[model samples]
Target: MSVNPTPLKPSQIPQEAFDWYDAYAHGAMDRRTFMKKLGTLVAVGYSMTALTSALLPNYALAEQVSFNDPEIIASYEEFASPDGHGKGRGYLVKPTKEIAAFPAVLVIHENRGLNPYVKDVARRLAKAGYLAFAPDALFPVGGYPGNDDAGRALQRELDREKIQQDFVAAARHLKAHALSTGKLGAVGFCFGGYMVNYLAAIDSDLLDAGVPFYGTPAAESLRKNIKAPLLVQLGELDERVNASWPEYEQDLKRYKVDYQMHMYKNAHHGFHNDSTSRYDQANADLAWERTLAFFAKHLT
Candidate 1:
């Protein structure tokens, strides 16, 4: 009879492993390199599968708000991106309760594309009474392959500039939709967080509010162009992303941008993501509570 190895707790995983997974998740490192590095853990009686299971996202855990929820309606919609990949599609969700018009929010996904977690995020937003749209940057390349590893590999092949344009186009489409009240907010994670920063930087009037979780800050030169209210969320241990915050914060202050930042103690990169081991529930809940309040104060 074959025996299964014990499942490792998130606390058992070393911080180095989490950092390596973050790099691998963002396409900064390839799978072979990531696996080789994890081999060190395997040598210590941990099975390869055990280490991966501890680090990788289990999408099954992502559906906090189900697609069939009676309170919201969800579907995929396409929009034109003349300057981008020419076209794009997004998962759009809206509350079922009737209203003359609803405030809209653009939810952006990480480098791994529009995985289940992001879709569920849109649903959660809708449940809160905001129309939410999450565009798939990987759509132009064939969309998310149902697995993050494949999704990340596919996303790395697309043109970065065009992808930015696609997101901009999606924002415009959501704002202009007949059901929209013309108010728009944006929230993103990792690469998506970077996009939220980029969108706010390039088109000051485009977003009414912006929330970026553990995303890279925009170039200092572009900081002067930002006009939207921003709520920046960072993890205390995310050295790679936090390194740029000091200079970015200085520039935001110099320009007098409306923004606030929260650094969760002892949290690591991707801490807001509940589907992975890096998730920090206490911090994530507090950050999200602040995010919803921030959007309500500005968008409503």
Candidate 2:
């Protein structure tokens, strides 16, 4: 008989740690307060290093992700956003293997501008057979400051309307790329998820579909204008985001929109990022598989 090993449960960390992380990811808290708050997780039989290392490996382990996938072509590129708010810079990735006009996806980051994790996400999308472009919202003001606090501060300074223009331009650039088919799609998290809804609503002719993870819902006014299908992923433990789902679903139904949504049980916001222990691998894997299937059906 084969034996199944028990799942690893992070017992030492407190739920409060995840709350602090949520606050940080959404730009609602500064690093000093976040760290001071998250530090409490170590009080229950865990060392500060051990628990921090587990909850947030990205802050430290990011350098190790020189994801040199031989099958992927990945690099940074700048594209024109003349009609947009300003020029855009993004981490671009595509499969090196011959592809006749591959489907393209715009990978949007969390509140923090284009960071290493989002770049890696672009590479993963490429490995999965789609062209992925992740734009940095702070490109006009230099770029993403390497530090978290600086990135969050820069995030607040952004003009919401102008930022939308940048994303519209970025998606257009991806769909228009020499190697891309006319089909265009997007996947965004948190801040980016909200962007996906906004962009899809306004550019019904351009955006084909969207997958938004823990992003705030589209307003009722915007729902009527949405042109693409939406695959929404929510974390059951995230009260701030979950509160909008009931009304959002009603709006989707009222508008007769094509959409699908799932709330991962016992999961918190940002569950898909493996760089953190907060990631629920089982749920994230299922969500990712479903997301890929959804994209293949709509984008391809």
Candidate 3:
């Protein structure tokens, strides 16, 4: 008696090669096992590659010379603190090949610390032909507390004063860098965002433009010293922080600061972060576009 071939489910096909396979094909394990294993490995490898690419999008661009590209070149450097007690460390991203001075952006990382995401952002800025510097605010305090139970523990012990000092020092370092365009701008997310706003208000001479996404400050009086153009991104769905944003915007308007505010509907606090559950791709993309545009218009 002749036996029918065993049918294979569509789910059985590896995701990587599913597009190339015939959906109707059915067979026993022995017939397709080799191909299946190969497909599975390929699928796994591809997934890992894509994930890695997303995390380190700037790797290739960082090392190459691309004037038209927006990926920034990353280099680590140490800056002497203004107080003269210790040295502050920061990562700088700049155009690989450029003759004249280029616009510079100072990026501040979130509470999670100076991770790959921040570096990628600096790379992005460099790719866009801007010199981007991301200083380690938590350096003096011993580094950032990544997102986890341990992170919370570190947050409680973070030294706010030292962070502020480090930020100021980082700005000074960027200004003195030979490749810097001298026209400096600042951008930060979450904790970094808060510091950006604070820095704008405190050190107006160091920045020509500032973009703060979902950052909070201890005092609004800092707004009086702001001398740069500001773009603030807010998420309406962020219940914890949304309440105070109105007041912050009002303060800016009240002070007659050159600023723009954007509120994304249904977005959360960490909407700009693609790696988090709170990430909202649509809003994040929009925010990035707005950020680059703002920097170009103001800094360049």
Provide the overall lDDT of each model, using Cα atoms, as 2-decimal numbers.
0.91, 0.81, 0.68
**After aligning candidate 3 to the native by TM-score, how far in Å is the CA of 5 from where it should be?**
31
Candidate 1 to truth, TM: 0.97
Give the CA lDDT, 0 to 100, for residue 251 in model 3. 79
Tens digit of per-residue lDDT, candidate 2, span 1-300: 955433334444577777777776676776788777756654554466655566654654333335687888888888888766558999988888876778999999887788777787788888889988999998888889886557878878888778788988898889899988978889998888888877777767878889999888755677788869999998888888888888888888887889999999988888887767777889988998988999999998
Name the top lDDT candidate. Answer: 1
Model 1, global lDDT: 0.91
Off by over 4 Å in 1: none
Q: Write the per-residue lDDT of candidate 1 for residues 69-161, one digit (tens) a residue.
A: 999999999999999999999998999997877899999999989999999899999999999999999998889889988888888788888
Full candidate order by TM-score, most accurate first: 1, 2, 3
**Prediction 2 TM-score vs. true:** 0.89
Residues 155-181, candidate 3, lDDT per residue (tens digit)?
445576776777888887887788887
Count of steric clashes across candidates, in order: 0, 0, 8
